[model samples]
Target: MQAHFDAQQRQRSKLTELGLGLSIDIVAALATSAVVAPFVAIIDRSIISNASGRMPLMAGLQDGFRTLATRPAVLARQPSVVAVFSVYAITYITANASETIALSANADPLLPKFLASSTVNIAACVYKDKLLTHWCSLGPARPFPMASYGLFGLRDSLTVAASFSLPPLLSTMLQSNTSMSKTSCDSISQLALPCMVQFISTPIHLLGLDIYNNPSATAVRRAQVVRRDFIPSTLARMGRILPAFGFGGLVNNKTRTTLKRWIL
Candidate 1:
């Protein structure tokens, strides 16, 4: 009778944990999205504008907010703006919810965190990129190529690893070597890795955008676009990535942790 009672208690505990976790995820997602979405939305527009050859990098950066300051109503109507907030909310909810489940199951949370964040980020980003590419086009919408998704997936996966998986490991190493607090280490690792990973992911991102934007262009022309855009696009991407993954990830995780401690 005692053993059976203990088993029942354990099952009840798991259910309670799950409920609490989902509540925390909702709160964290909202909190992070409220803070991060505006910056991400602007930087995202800049990257896409620069990639699509709509404008030069510096001009694109300025133009993102220029529309907002000058024409708030028009900026409010843009689909990409809505997509940015939605993606951030969805990503944080999935990331923390999966981690919560892994904890309840007595499993390593890192793998679930990595998998959930990576899959959701890649899908959300590819769809957003496709939408923005068409939005920026002077011509009518063309069919999106499958190859674009494949390339974007590869790039986003590397970024997901840098954002979710590698940060904890990097923080651990940093903490071991230095006397900084865990928060400091976590912040540094979160910010630094995403910026560094852009070097590798930027070219792939530009190539994927080129292919999607001008699917009929020759290989030589595609290569030339990639080469020409490489430096500015890479720099623009690094700026965008810092807000999206670096500060965003850190803020989301910290909010989840703080909320869990306070309420759960």
Candidate 2:
């Protein structure tokens, strides 16, 4: 009787695991579609519009200049907006790449894992290079914005948290072939809940930045003209952070073990 009960419990656990996997697959598909659909529509419209022989390469130049000239003064004063957006962009790219690396590591197709890791490394290198270039270009006359630095720190925290979570979730999911482990199942559930919180926080962050900074024509022109200094600064920041990340990995034997196992 006990053996039968155990078998039944295992069967129920497997069913639950299959259901959860399906749900995750569905959500991932929808999330990707939601992001891609608008991009596709915009690209399609651009292609269709440019297909006409009458399309002038500089047709929008006058309008663009005019829009820039008329931009609000508040935006010019609020450097925090640019800083916040830059930080968010950096964090998002890093977090997503890290997540992809973790998830793809244990995938059945070796190609996916290789591609994901390659892409992430390339992106990180590029961003770090950009950050370094930007920092070097900024002369002594132009001081670093304190508010921007603060915002960047906050964004980094978010990125680190997200990056840390991905490994555990991926490891948990890949642990059991039959998916009967309650701990593994619960990890995925917990991982998903934070993403929902991130979704909610994003709009609030955007709105807050918008309220403080309204885009103006002059600000737009200034942005276009200003040599990006963020790139070099970002690279330097990464140099400091990467060592710490490596140290943490070394200290956490379980994480290191999981990473190595998945990599192989």
Counting only residues 3 or more apart in sequence or on different chains, how many pairs clash (N, Cα, C under 3 Å) in candidate 2? 13
Residue 50 error for model 2, in Å?
23
Give each model's whole-structure lDDT: 0.84, 0.35
lDDT of 1 by residue, 88-192 (tens): 788888888888888888999999899998899889978887887788755678888899889989998999899889999999999999999998999999999
Residue pairs that clash (backbone atoms under 3 angstroms), model 1 = none
Q: How far is candidate 2 from the true structure (C-alpha RMSD, Å)?
A: 18.3
117 in model 1: Cα distance from truth in Å? 1.9
Cα lDDT of model 2 overall?
Answer: 0.35
- The alpha-carbon deviation from the true structure for residue 185 of candidate 1, after best TM-score superposition, in angstroms, is 1.3
Question: Tens-digit lDDT track for model 2 on 1-264?
Answer: 999999999888766644544344333333332332222222212211222212221332333234335753443233322332233233333433444444544544234433443344334433332342233232222333434334333443343443344445555666654455755454443344334334333332222222223223255543432223223223322332332222222233233335445533
RMSD (Å) of each candidate, 1 decimal: 2.1, 18.3
Best by lDDT: 1
Candidate 2 local Cα displacement, residue 114, angstroms: 24
TM-score winner among the candidates?
1
Model 2 vs. true fold: TM: 0.25
